[model samples]
Target: MANLIFPSDFEWGAATAAYQIEGAAAEDGKGKSIWDTFTHQKGNILNNDTGDIACDHYHRYQEDIALMKEIGLDTYRFSISWPRVLPAGKGKVNQKGIDFYKRLVNQLLEAGIKPAATLYHWDLPEQLQLKGGWENRDTIYYFQEYAELMYSELGDLVPRWITHNEPFVVSMVGNLFGEHAPGYQDYNKALQVAHNLLVSHGLAVDSFRESGIKGEIGITLNLNHVYAKTDSKEDQQAKDYCDAFNNRWFLDPVFKAKYPTKLLALYQDKFGGFEIETGDMEIISREIDFLGINYYSRAVVEYAEDELLKHKTIKPEQAIYTAMNWEVYPDGLRDLLIRLNKEYTDKEIFITENGAAFADQLAADGQVHDQPRVDYLREHFKAAYQAIEAGVPLAGYYVWSLLDNFEWAFGYSKRFGIIHVDYQNQQQRTLKDSAKMFKQVIADNGLTD
Candidate 1:
């Protein structure tokens, strides 16, 4: 049994997205999403794995909720599929989509769990992608419309709403880097996508307020607290480049009504300063209720001085890495939370997504042995505990995943889930050691050595 240890109100939960979990790919008026198309394409995903039947969560949500209850979760964070809502990404709302979410929301509420809703979680409608996706200004209006529709429907039940989940990733990986859906590799398009996403965020936030919904609204950012390899000035500058690329870009607009000057200088001619009309910055600069910080690990900087690495990415020398090849550094989480609280926005921060993907399997007794994940989260949760103790206004903690669902292009190969899901049989789940450890942390209300 978990010891009653957290503060009176610290939220404990797990998160999942529609495209990653809900299988009924083309069912009940659901239109195609970018992920659907991307997964269907050969060579686009690992081993040509698709999310077509991922965990079968659509039919197994009640089972999933039951698992959440059994694990003693206090909150549940889930995303609304854009294509499922508005099949074409614009015009004519689908009742079926709302019905799916309503069922999920009702289930969460019935289980005495708070519902934290994410409006967009990287599953852009395929039709929207055909029209340039995030690069086009038109998509912003569509997103806001969708947000309004959600608030109109499920706002009464969900007390917290996340506007966009990792806009930086949607733009950087999907557009600039071409590693994700609707892949494009133009730096200019990436910049435009960033600007457009921020605008959509602004529009959505404003629209949410206008809807008179009584809830806290914010955005989630996948932050990598970068550290200089040494005290050298070049390495410091490399860290600065990494910061501007990851945190400062979206943060500046949300908190300061201005994009980071450091970043603008680096990508000026490439994207022409993320063009903004009158009052656009003001719109983007509105006060947010909180900032969701998804801290996995930090990047160590080496001064590459080359034009390519100089302004783009900070190369790390760390031998330790994730299945996604990301370095494992717990101190990075503390550094990032402290930096954001001190140097950047003073908003309430939540460790939204902090979990490691490792080679995991179900043991003979139905227990998943994910020791690396347990270690990763324990270290990071300690860092998060430090953040809260340091007066960072932290409110809650939710692990990256509830189940081992489709992990984008990496597919099922990456297991970031606290619970193991058998993709072949679409069987429900088994709690991992990490999940038990998390339960211990939650029960203790804080990290106990």
Candidate 2:
């Protein structure tokens, strides 16, 4: 292969979520989040493991920041625990909780790293969830208030603010599939949650603009390239419906100010039409400065008469698979990027999250040799470089995580971080070979084979 170079000004960084890392679950007036509540239930998470002490980031943020600085990262993306800030979900602010993030931001700046903050990353305040969660329209206003508070406190310090990370997962996984926190399984409720999430995103963008914050605001969506299993018309139709369900369900409303007509029509009988109130679409369609995309793998769909969406995903037998059982299809990243640029808005796109999970271990040689992860990242970087060359306004890339923290419902079983964390050993961090290679990639502004 050849050298894969990126734009000189392109950003290089890593991302982590709050509930996944910061493990001061009940410290300093920090109220419980939905994850905290869900993980406590029996058989909810893998091995019944909880994030009660995952990575201990709340006490070791400085150590983590130092690692990021050592990795030559230009930016560090992290989320704020909603319950930590507003313990009761509304009313008063938690000074101690605010101070923790303040310290983290200051340390990042002192280390010459730009702080990218995400408002909500599925860690909804338990109090809010009790009042119907994202399915309730009132949750939108609560999110707006939370956004305003965050901007008032940290807006001037952070350069980039993401309203929400992967709202699709929050809606479909958490609400419809009953896989994640605040788990519920209902189709109508899932649609409601999805709509409210977009509303909240728009409200946050509007609040950011109204506050006159100097930073850019956007929302992150987990998107995938959908391919038909065969050239048959039924398979093609299945692929289109799956795309609308997974990708366009979130993308169209934000970029085009409308839902995909095919999906809307298909779900009309089941959902009884969206509970759209006056000015809801207008708020959901509010423009923003950029769009953040989190791409992992692609889906190959075939027609299924009995499936709810009339589509069933078929995994390719010959393809390499990650520990997450996702196919290692790097070209999917390039295809998705180009499609977004051509079919959606031309605004700048930031890869807010991208990484693979592999069963990594610390060898007796006193090092972690994660060659597979390094190869995965290298191929994906090449795909991103191809997207940039093909006229996609690719701006930056943030690896999915900076540390191997909690993996949601999968719990501590999956490892996605380039830096390995010894969970049983006080969360001891070890920089893997992949981290070293990524540092070099950042230094060179590209990939070297």
Candidate 3:
């Protein structure tokens, strides 16, 4: 078999969120975030684990960047903690917080690794949440202000900026499902939150252009292809609705400047609809330089009369499963990429987040024999190569994480990093076999069969 080669300019890297890795939670006059509040509450996160000292990256970023250099990464994608910078989410800059990110960016540059910064990754400042959070339109401007601050401070150092990471997850999981921070159990609220997030994203794009920053700006969405469980019309309809809910609900607004008509009608009829201010859609549809996608698995759905979306996802027993219980469907990435290219905007695409978790342990030789993770990444890389072959302008790939820090609601139960972190032993970092494989892939820019 021929070797799967990527474009010569293809970028390779890894990603991590601030709250998940940079644990100096309350140090340096940083304000509390929703995650901080949620994690502290009992019966919220698994194992009662919190991100209080996750990976201790705040004090160990130098070491982490050294690891990134050792991995031969072309770039490193990390998020900024909202509360870390703006203690009240809008007013009064925390110089310490701003200084910390400056240090991190400078170090990445020194290591010859380009830095990609994500403005938001679900860590809303607790102070803002108290004021109705994203449900209130005022939060949109606050976010824009925050965006401007980041741009003015570090825009010259970081060339790539992602406005938000997975707004769907931020709205649906955090609001509707009540699994994440600022937990609320109302679909109506979730819809409002989602709309506000898009508005804020648009405002951020506007700010970026206005600031005359030379960096590229985009949003990272968690997108997956939806499949019908059967040939029945009911299943097909369910698939369409699921697609609208998961993919098009966000995609259409950013790319086409409109919501899916059917879903919009259903939402209006069922929940009285969210308020779409005049010109909001136009703002949300601002032209972006690229589209960042986080593809992990596919969705297979069947119709259900009593279901909320009138659909229910069905898991196939024949599929391989990740530790997160997500199916390992590499072909879904290829199909999703092709579909996005044929249907969505013509912007250059990047896999901003893609990786899986498995139950692997350190062996006697002080090496982690994570063969499953190695295989998982290899198959996904092949799928990405196939997407590029199909004329998709795939420009880069960033693994889900560079360290096994905090895993959110599931806490530290799920490990999604190539480098294992020994939390019990002062967060000792050890590169698993998968990391070794990735280093080679980055060096070769391809994989051999």
List the candidate 3 regions with Cα displacement exceeding 4 Å: none
Q: After superposition, how far is residue 216 of candidate 2 from its true place, in Å?
A: 0.4
lDDT of each: 0.84, 0.93, 0.95
Global lDDT of model 1:
0.84
- Tell me which residue pairs clash in candidate 1: 5-444, 5-445, 6-445
Error of 1 at 402 (Å): 0.6
User: Tens-digit lDDT track for model 2 on 267-314?
Assistant: 896668768888888898899889999999999999999987899999
Residue 260 lDDT, candidate 3, scale 0-100: 97
What is the Cα-based lDDT of residue 89 in candidate 1? Answer: 95
Task: Write model 1 residue lDDT over 274-368, tens digit each, in one string.
Answer: 66778888888777898987877777667776655463344465457888788888888877888889976777777777788888888888788
Candidate 1 residues lying further than 4 Å off, grouped into runs, are: 1-6, 309-319
Q: Per-residue lDDT for 87 in model 3?
A: 89
Give lDDT: candidate 1, residue 118.
92
Q: Can you write out model 3's per-residue Cα lDDT over 1-449, one digit (the tens) per residue?
A: 58887889999999999999999999998999999999999999999999999999999999999999999999999999999999899989999999999999999999999999999999999999999999988999999999999999999999999999999999999999999998899989999999999999999999999999898999999999999999999999999999999999999999999999999999999999998999999999999999999999999999998986889999998889999999999999999999999999678999999999998788899999999899999999999999999999999999988999799999999999999999988899999999999999998899965
Best by lDDT: 3
For model 3, name the residue pairs that clash: none
Task: Give the lDDT of residue 341 in candidate 2.
Answer: 95
Candidate 3 versus the native: TM-score? 0.99
